[model samples]
Target chain A: MIVATSGLTKRFGRVTAVRDVTLEVPRGVRFGLLGPNGSGKTTLVRMLLGLVHATSGSIEVLGEPMPRRARVVLPRVGALVEGPAAWGHLSGRANLRLLDAAGPGRSRHRRKRVDAVLEQVGLGGIDRRPVRAYSLGMRQRLGIAAALLREPELLLLDEPTNGLDPRGIQEMRALLTSLNEAGTTVVLSSHLLTEVEALCTHVGVMDAGRLALDSELAALRTPTGRVLVRTPEPDAVVGLLDGQVVDRRGDTVTVRGVEPATLNARLVAGGVRVTGLSEERRTLEQVVLELTGSGTDRVDRSPHGRRPEGPR
Target chain B: MIGVELRLMLRRRRVWLCWVLLCTLPTLVAILLATTRLAPPPGRGGAFLSAVTSNGQIFPAAALALVIPIFLPITVAIVAGDTVAGEASAGTLRYLLVRPVGRVRLLLAKLISVAAFVLLAVLFVTLVSYVVGVAAFGFGPDASLGGTGAIPSLSGVELTPVDVVARTATTVGYLALCMLALGAVGLFFSTLTDSPLAATLGVLAFVVASAALQPLDAASAIEPYLPTSHWLAWIDLFRDPILWTNVRGGALVQLGYVVVAFGAAWANFSTKDVTT
Candidate 1:
């Protein structure tokens, strides 16, 4: 595993920001941590990077104890916690240089590495404008460039696609995908479900400071023992399948406990014209919503509503 | 980490502005003294003001006197207080920490940077005031006194130019140490809060309280222990015999402050959760 945390918990005074989160990310996987705002995703990410010490439990990144061996391990781990931050008064390139110099690295390759990362992030032509003057999208790109400075073995990014337009997001996704393909373990935390669903090979959902669900994306998306059939003669198909049809909308009929091939062969034999046929599977959104509660940002006036479970 | 810290400090326009304003104050004072031909009477104005009109070379001493009380402390406090808190507020502290800059190393770098700033500020003030002083008031009646031209010590005895330069260098080093003690206090307060302004104010309040209690008979029991009580002790360096009594005592006190304040800062910062 590139990153492992067993029973990791963090508390800030009266509030428990992260609660007994035991997460494991195997090597060379694009892992997406999905959660709503205030669900402890950022706090968990901070702990993993050793920016926030855990009140209890332990963390190991790159197979060495975090923060204890942080000096040796962190140089190999790249991260963007909360968001991208740099000295506003300095140009982006100068900021990168200073950040690189602050860490453990050979100075001779500093310029070459910085230029390579800037080019990778599509900011190679960026001029000497202070970071404060860059557009939000430009700053976001610069933040990514800072993370990629040392060509880390593991990349932990929090909301990496924030402030990005559709094109920018697409480019970021492509960049992450290519990096993962090149044997870099990538872990990104974001509240955007679609973003996670599109990029991650493994997904972990956080809700109210608890890990609600953790599983491989392929396992969580197994076929639901149902097949969706579309036919102009819905009534005929329903008649042919009988009680097997559980739902119908327009020309589409949902058939349960039946293989798509069996149903298709039966339909054709029964002279029912089938236009589209496929097995049904649960979408990641459905699995996530079922495991996690509503987002924490919503507040209701009534006090009788069901409170989220855990130590208050 | 120290190199990066110094580069960051040097790149800041605010640091440069502080140094300029520090140098400017003494230059302005020189202009006023020259234009009016009125130097405050002996023992009445700044420590060496009266002597400055006679030997322009002594104006650096008067300039140091002019800024030691308030201007210098305020600038030092601002820079030191902003050391950690500024980065926290700007959201770069976490990045630096995750850059794996050890907490202790970063603190050490910041303290060194603050010391560098104080030294630079003092050096600029001394250099600028010397130039202004020589331009406004000539090299004094001693310039024609041949190769062994002598300047008067505070004790009214003649001293060679070498002695004057040595004493001035000692004074500069002493004053820098004093300001570093104050900067250490600012650094401690900086670790206590994420607000740079609050840390700066905390440092200023500390100095004010120390100054306020310095001369009070009621506080006399603790007077020797106060940070500001020994600030003026550097003046002893200008005496012909070079009184090392107060200067030694003051250096010890400042060293104590640096140790204790820096200890507190490291204790608080090492385990900080860095939520910001």
Candidate 2:
């Protein structure tokens, strides 16, 4: 695991931002932290990077316990915590120079590295422009350039596309995807579900300062393969299905391990008029709503019913 | 790391503007004093004119005295105040902390950057003063500048130009240390909030309040510890037999403030949560 947090918690005064949340990110995986506003996504990212101290729990990054080992571990990790915070007065290249100089990489080809990263982030020829003049997207890109300075093993970005345009988000998404493919462990927090869906291999959903859902995107997106059959004669529909049929509703029945064609044939043979039949496939959005609750505004009961069981 | 930080500090337009202003003050003062006689009515510029006319080499020393009270302090205050809180306000502190750089190292870099700024400001001021002072008045054979109206302790003593230069260097050095103390205070306030303006005003307000309150009898006991209490102690260096009492005490006091203020700043900043 690139990162492992067990029962991590953070509290500000009476408010607990992250509570008893445990998560693990495997090596070279694009891990996405998805949550609504104030759901402790940023707070969790901060704790992992050792920017904010956890109230309780252990955080191990790259097998080193942090923040006690933060100074040594940070050199191998790059993060853009809140946003792209660069010196407004300095040019993009100049700001990165300061960061690279202070970075632990200490590569002698500093200028070459900076130039390469700037170009990598699409900030090539315009690196001389002062950060104050750059658009928000450009500043965000430059921040990523700084994060990419060391070619770190792990990248922790908090809402990297927070204020970005569509094209900027696309570029950032593609860049992060490529980085992860190249063996860098990427952990990003974002509210945009599509962004997470497009970029992440694994996801952890935070609800009210707790990890409400943790699973692979493929697993979350997996189709149930069960077919839904609706009819007026509920008692007759049970005999029409060969597999164990369960009532999906008063008139509908759900059958497992039976194809839609087989069920339709059986229903026709049984002389039951099938009004409607469809496969059961739930989108990640539905799963999120179901796990978090229809109204996450109030502290509702822990509806861990749908939280998938088994090891990730 | 420090080299890069100092380079960034030197590249800022604001820092350049301050340098221009500091250089201009001594240049204008030297020209106005050198070209014209020192026979102005004795209210505001009288003491400086007397000191300069008595010995032109004393122009640099006198000029520092005239401006150290407000101009130099404000300059140093702005730099120190901008160092920490400015990054926080601009949202850059979070980025800096995520690198290999430790919080202590980052704060130390800021301290060095501001210290470099203080050094440059003092050196530039003194350099401009010296060039102008020499051009306006010859460099050699300056009479003893001590025990005049400002001191009246060791008058009529002749001194070579070397001693004058040495004393001026010491004076500048002392003023720089004093400014470092002031910078440390500004740095402390900078760590408290994210607004650089608030930090700057906070520093200025504290110094102004200290000076403003030093006059009351009730505040007399705390006067010695004030940042500006021994500001003019460099003047005593002009005495033939230098008075080390106030100068040493002032240096010690400034050092004490430096230690305490920087300790407080590091303590607060190291553990600070970079919300911005």
How far residue A9's Cα lies from its native spot in candidate 1, in Å, is 1.3
Cα distance off (Å), candidate 2, residue A167: 3.8
**Superposed model 1: Cα runs more than 4 Å off:** A231-259, A265-273, A302-312, B144-149
Q: How good is the docking of model 1, as DockQ?
A: 0.80
Docking class of 1: medium
Candidate 1 local lDDT, A1-312, one digit each (tens): 999999998888888878999999999999999987888999998988888899999999999998799999888988888889999999999999999999887898888888899999999998899999998888899889988988899999999999999999999999999999999999999988899999999999998888988889999998999999988999998888898889999999999998888888898999989899998999988888888766667754456677543322
Q: In model 2, which residue pairs have backbone atoms overlapping below 3 Å? A: B147-B152, B147-B153
Q: Of the true interface contacts, what fraction does each candidate have?
A: 0.86, 0.74
| Per-model RMSD to reference | 2.4, 6.6
Determine the C-alpha RMSD for candidate 2 after optimal superposition of all C-alphas: 6.6
Local error of candidate 1 at residue A273 (angstroms): 4.1
Best-fitting candidate, measured by DockQ? 1
The runs of at least 3 residues in candidate 2 whose Cα sits more than 4 Å from the true structure, single-residue gaps closed, are A222-259, A263-280, A293-312, B34-47, B137-154
The lDDT of model 2 is 0.81
Candidate 1 residue A274 Cα shift, in angstroms, is: 3.5
Relative to the true structure, how large is the alpha-carbon lDDT of every model? 0.91, 0.81
